[model samples]
Target: MSATRLTVGWVPLTDVAVLIAAAERGFAAREGLDLVPVREASWANTRDKLVFGHFDAAHMLAPLAVATTLGLGHVALPLVAPFMFNLGGNAVTVSRPLAAALAAHGGLTGDLADAGAALGAVARERLAAGQGPLTFAAVFPFSTHAYQLRLLFLAAGLDPERDVRLVVVPPPFMVDALRRGLVDGFCVGSPWNSVAVDQGVGTILLLGNAIVPRAPEKVLAVPAERAQAPEIAALIRALAAAAAWCATPENRADLAALLAEPRHLDAPAEVVRRTLDGALVIDGAGTVRSDPDFLLLGANRPEPRQADWLADAMVAAGHLPQDAGNAARAVFRADLYDAALAARTRG
Candidate 1:
């Protein structure tokens, strides 16, 4: 019999490794699933397409699921994330010009406090000079990337709304935007940050973990109505297998190769390696870090807290109401996760 084909949407980030791993490692095949990984433009597009039924499920931003569940984005079709794909693959990178200004003020290597203070000084100088407000980019308005960026600015006593301009730029064009001076800085996921540093168009300001430790990244999100399907269960199980394999240090190189597929990132294997290995790259400085910090699609990876935290982020960002906790939990689908973990443990 032919395998059941399922379409899974994903943005072009290194953290979406579970979807790629399941496809490349034959785990999906073993589960009798033909997973067609659809590449999306932006988080908003991914969420909209998934809600409209253009996608069966997606590698979604955690906040988008909570927002959709609360009808914040219009049409509250509940969605659930049974597994987290990965974590801590994001960074805040400033354009070369902005980096130069910050460097001139002090340097990029300063701790988070100093970095924010330097940027604030720059923002003030620009304001006094009667120049336009400095603009920054984030992947989505409701994403952790955005909120984290805002929090970082706030921690430095810079008002995100008044001192700097925050806009949504597609991840693929972040480097180009920096090169063209369209934006001063961006908070985006890996490969893009590595790509920017490699191209010499941008400099890394801080890692996502530096801003917020143990941050939730991507998740295997599905519409709540579709969670009843046996195929969805199988996909979650296959994701578990792929996550188990990916969590092994021996599989790191192989996982990097899969991410380097021409149709996917097509970035250098070394860049992908650093991303998977959680090494910090500052102006192309490759320093090995012990954290790796990636939350693969696994039972141990704080999947429930991922939901709670994401929902809280959505509420914080004004995408969802704070009282929608019950509704948010309904969409996180811990039962599906429990089932997937049981199967993984049994076999």
Candidate 2:
């Protein structure tokens, strides 16, 4: 008889490339595992389902796993991130009006400290004129995008909580929100950022790299209890190997095509290519830059040290303790990652 299959849930996003690669490239099948990729409508839905044991594993926001593990925000569970999927694909964007206001405030350039002061100045001016506090959107409260937005505001000397409203809007509606004047700006992963710019509804403010510099963005999180099962363990090992395969340059193009399938992102191949190649158009100007290091897949580097930084952002945004470093690191599960690496290499 065939082994019992495992179901994994994922939010449709470009960074989810590794999961798609594993499913489509026969990596999961070779591990004697039946991997079912379920599409999720929202981050909240994905997290809740995982917490309810409806999902065996999931592609989760790195911070969400940390936050959930620590009971910092809402639900607490023993979540384990066995592998990091990708890094550095988030971008902060502003509506045309907000972008114009920021540009007029002295060109949105400089270190976080300088940007913080400039943003504060803009906020002060808006308040004096009796304008509404600016609003921004991110995928989730504990997501990298939220942290990146907070970092940008802090550098501009604006208190994220008091100075503006930070809200959660799903990725698919990001451009619409910007276009409708519902949010002044947002921080989201690609290709939403690229989508907004391409649709001419928003301006790219800063890349996530500018806020934290090659931060850990996403992780392959499995329930801690189930991860101990032998079949699940074997699947995890194969996933690690697939990630390693994706790290090679020659394989990226093929991976991109696979990710563009209707069952996957269903976005244009060019958009996927732009995401991988980092061909960006700045502030509606059709100039492109060659940024090959846009998203790191199956990276041959240390696991993204995201927990502390993510918790720090939570603290900065008033969601958790100011010094949540120790609590945050508890759930990262780097040991599992190392073991998976060993399994892949030994095979």
Name the candidate that leads on lDDT: 1
Q: How close is candidate 2 to the true structure, as a TM-score?
A: 0.91
Alpha-carbon RMSD of each model: 2.2, 2.3
Which pairs clash in the backbone of model 2?
112-155, 115-156, 116-155, 116-156, 116-157, 117-156, 117-157
Give the TM-score of each candidate: 0.92, 0.91
lDDT of 1 by residue, 1-347 (tens): 79999998998888878888898799999989999999987888888889899999999877777777767747877888777777667888888778888888674763677788788888889999999788989998768889888877886677877888999998888989998999989999888988888888888888787777778777778988877788988898888788888778789899888888878887887888777787756674543333456333344333566667777766766666678666556666768878866776787
Query: Which residue pairs show backbone clashes in model 1?
Result: none
Tell me the deviation in Å of residue 330 in model 2: 2.0
Encode model 2's per-residue lDDT on 60-172: one tens digit a residue: 88888877776665667877777778878887888877777777876456345555666778888998899978899999988888878877777766787888889999877
Best by TM-score: 1
| Clash count in backbone of candidate 1 | 0
With candidate 1 superimposed using the best TM-score fit, by how many Å does residue 11's alpha carbon deviate from the native? Answer: 1.1
